[model samples]
Target: MILLVVGADRVDAGKTTFSTGLLERTGAVGYKPRAGNDFWFDHDDCRRALADGRLYGKDAARLSAAASRGRAPERLNPVHRLWQPSPDGGSGLLGRSDREFVVDRIGRDPEDALFVRNATAEVPDAVADALPLADAVSIETVAEFNDLTEREYVPAFDRLADEIEDTDVAVVESYSDIARPLSSLDPAQVAAVAAVEPGRVRIYSGDRYCRACEIASSSPRDGAIEKRVPDVLDYLDPLERVRLPPLDKEQRDDPARIARAYANAYDAFLDAAGRV
Candidate 1:
């Protein structure tokens, strides 16, 4: 069964924190299909991962650690993108004014494939040198990037889904506010869906939630057209709403502590999912 955890806020909705606790309580495996970090803001994390000849955001790392049988961060998160801010009022290949794409790490292998954007020449020398450029696919435009994702990332996600089938429950976390991370995932496969904010979580029926996503997207189910949380929520009523207490830094990091503190909320989620 799949328990999807999605963010209501665009950023910092505590999806990872909530998912960690759920995994601890249920002994479920974790999966973060896609994730990213900014080069300017998440410098330390970027540098550390680069030092190990890889790239992965902290969320994926934490999810891997919280799982019943811990997996490699790359295997847990199949697609990770690196971004940098454009301070000089310039745009990258994707045409975003504030930030530009640097590179993308796709698939799960000892030597994962890298998609280095042509705009990387504009990045700082130290950061560029540290990137895994050897045997990397060079991308020049948004269309090319989209093509690459269709060709490569889709298959990687498929493989990851196949791997998850062996586990009893898989906690699937969506990126940002995206309703569903994997387009291929059937609604019937999901046990429950949770939309989380700062101090509360709203539970919805899995099939209804996926149908809402389809309505919100209003496009073909290619996983390319993503709908935000509010857009999907417009079509359905929640099964339950549970309040969450604030956690101290130590408590937030400890999965067992989080599970204990959030026992009520977890119970509500399981009950809504029909697991109880």
Candidate 2:
């Protein structure tokens, strides 16, 4: 399966929309390897679950709805980070110094538990065994909070890497820009995108300010292809690229109309990918 890294030069550059379009058009699954942001749920039940700490992410929920086939939403986003404050005054999402919450979640899988146990001897068996049976775990650890450590990140990275390896046409969405000196897209993440075989990883840039373009331009291109995504207003034909009038604000805001735009963009992307 090809690995398509859907990313933008800046935040809210329509990465998710583009990915959603691809999933809708191609039947490809979505995997958010590393997500660090707020969870927003439009459904009242999801909001309540999040308030109660039972559910953690909004992006995962939507991705699950759009893709996941029959798998759980949590599987798509195994490790996540948010800005919730911990009890200790430290800013990690998960409260407490011992981080039993993180340990427990990762340790739920017997093999993953072993990996966690090996990462730090401080983890107790009860915590390891207490892995919630739920499909996903909401991790509140963030680097900004200074709550994340190498031990925790290692397991999360392992999970991320494992998923990418196992997935077919993994649409990896980048977090932030890597070219900006202080970008969210780490060098390691860029390396992961680069690791895909040449011509297998399709890097598409969105809009004029896209950071993904910088990444694509700066990163080594042994065989990987980089193409500009068609503007949302375009009526893209898989056989030919066509331009259409831009959508008015009302039409753009309509979910149904935006979905159609994504479909067109996906056609263009797939067409470009085919030629490569």
- Model 1, runs deviating above 4 Å: 217-223
Q: What would the TM-scores of all predictions be?
A: 0.92, 0.49
lDDT of all predictions, in order shown? Answer: 0.82, 0.40
Angstrom error of the Cα, residue 90, model 2: value is 12
What's the distance in Å from true for residue 166, model 1? 4.4
Clashing pairs in 1: none
Residues 1-276, model 1: lDDT tens digits:
899999999889989999999999999889999899988999989888888778888998888888847477888898898888877666557666787777778876637465555544365565668666656788776688688777888888888877766568889999888888877775787889989999999999898888888888543222256688888998999999999889999998999999998888899899978852
Clashing pairs in 2: 9-210, 9-211, 93-140, 94-140
RMSD of each: 2.5, 11.3
Point out where model 2 deviates above 4 Å. 3-5, 38-47, 84-149, 178-259
